[model samples]
Target: MARFCLPRDLYHGKGALAELKNLKGKKAMICVGGGSMKRFGFLQKAEEYLKEAGFEVQLYEGIEPDPSVETVMKGAAAMEAFQPDWIIAMGGGSPIDAAKAMWIKYE
Candidate 1:
């Protein structure tokens, strides 16, 4: 049998960052690739938001486009080191999807 897991809270739409205020966590690991987040300036905003929510944010960036299996391993290793309670992956679909797989590997 296959198993599935869902987030306890899934908040979308506008200004979802406000929801972070309710998150209970001491550390957060943000996974990403390239400059899209930084180019749009969402990266800094997200980092600050997590910090404001009392989470120590550590970024695992440069995951790269298409993100090879090796990249996933490296990201997972970084995540292991960060030991974050919350995994925040922001970027295009590829990185998010890859990070999700990496997240599973971390667990």
Candidate 2:
């Protein structure tokens, strides 16, 4: 049998990032790509919101476009070390895709 997993809750639209403050978890790992999220202040806001939610958050930044094997391994290793209860993929498709791969590797 094939198994599929999905987020229990999904939030979007204006101020959706702020929804991080409502997540219940002890730790969260944020996976992000290049500087766009940071340049736009979304990254910082996410960190702040997660903190406000009482999560010990760690950032794994600079997930490159398309992502490479080494990047995935590095991200998986970080996830292993952090042992986060939640993995938040921020930024564009690259980051989210990379995070999915990392999750598989981490598991």
Candidate 3:
């Protein structure tokens, strides 16, 4: 049988990213693409919130526009090493999609 898995909670809107502070986890791995999020300050804000929530945040930046298999492998390896309880993907669709694939690979 086919099965599905989804986040238990989903928050949106301008300050939605702030909700990261509420996540209960010891570690969080933030996946991002390029420097748009960083340039806009969203990336720093996300990290700060996660850190405020007592999570050890590790960043896996530069996920590229259309991530490659090698990139996925590297991200998976990083996830393995970091052993994060949560994976926070920021930026555009590329990073999110890459993170999703990395999530599957890590598991």
Candidate 4:
């Protein structure tokens, strides 16, 4: 037998990232891919929103396309160290997918 768990909330669409400000938690870890999100200021925005939510945020950047097993392990380690109450992945599919795998290991 196997068990699976998914986050209870998901936000999407333009300005949806602002929804981070509504999350209730003491700490949050953000997982990202590449520099585009940073170059475009989305990363900073996420940080701001998370902070506004009163969460101490940590970032794990540069999860590559199709992320390797090593990357997943590194992310999981970071999560363990940070002990975040929540995890947020911002960017394209790679970072989000990697975060999902990392979250499983984190739990």
Candidate 5:
């Protein structure tokens, strides 16, 4: 059989973070930035969802805009320790973009 492992099984939009509820991972590392997700409480929702899914979820926040290479390395180090099967990025462009870089390093 071919070997292929996609990131996460599902991505729910609008309220996609809720999708974490169904994940089967033992751990999840969430990368976020600024305060939008927190202000709206999406970060809490995402964490709750992951926990509901039976995962030991943690967050790596304060990612800056146009994230730097240093930031990516630090995030990657965090993932190495968490050893999460899932990576949830919530917030603005900085978080998403930084999450992408972290993803590459994680793999």
Candidate 6:
């Protein structure tokens, strides 16, 4: 048998990042890949939004395309050390995939 799980809540559209303010947490770790998000200013906006939400935000940037085992382990170690209540995967799919692995290792 197989089971699938999904996030309890999903927010989107223009201003979706602002919804972070409604989340109940003190710390949040943002995982991002490459430079697009940074170049485009989404990364900064995310940090600001999280801060406005009262979270101490930490960033795990530079997750590469097709992420490596080493990267995943390093991200997991960072997560272990930071012990954030929320892990926000930003940017593209690579960061999100890396964050998922890191979350599993963190648990």
TM-scores of the candidates in the order shown: 0.86, 0.91, 0.91, 0.94, 0.84, 0.89
lDDT per residue for candidate 5 within 10-37, as digits (tens), equals 3546767766787787988989888788
Best-performing candidate as measured by lDDT:
4
RMSD of each: 1.9, 1.5, 1.6, 1.1, 3.6, 2.0
* Top TM-score prediction, candidate number: 4
| Model 6 pairs whose backbones collide | none
lDDT of 1 by residue, 62-104 (tens): 8788888998998899889889899887777677877788888
Clashes of each: 0, 0, 0, 0, 1, 0
Those runs of model 4 whose alpha carbons end farther than 4 Å from true positions after fitting are: none
Question: What TM-score does candidate 5 get on C-alpha atoms?
Answer: 0.84
**TM-score of candidate 4 versus the correct structure, residues matched by position:** 0.94
Tell how far residue 49 is off in model 4, in angstroms.
Answer: 1.1
Q: Write the per-residue lDDT of candidate 2 for residues 1-107, one digit (tens) a residue.
A: 97868556555679899889988989999999999999999989999999999999999999999999999999999999999999999888899889889998888
For model 6, residues 8-105, the per-residue Cα lDDT tens digits are 65456798888887878899999999989899998898888889889999999999999999999999999999999999988777988898888888
Better of 1 and 3 by TM-score: 3
Model 5 worst lDDT window (10 residues): 3-12
Clash count, predicted structure 5:
1
Alpha carbon deviation, residue 86, candidate 3 (Å): 0.3
For lDDT, candidate 2 versus 5, the one ahead is 2
Q: Where is model 3 more than 4 Å wrong at Cα?
A: 1-10
lDDT of 1: 0.82
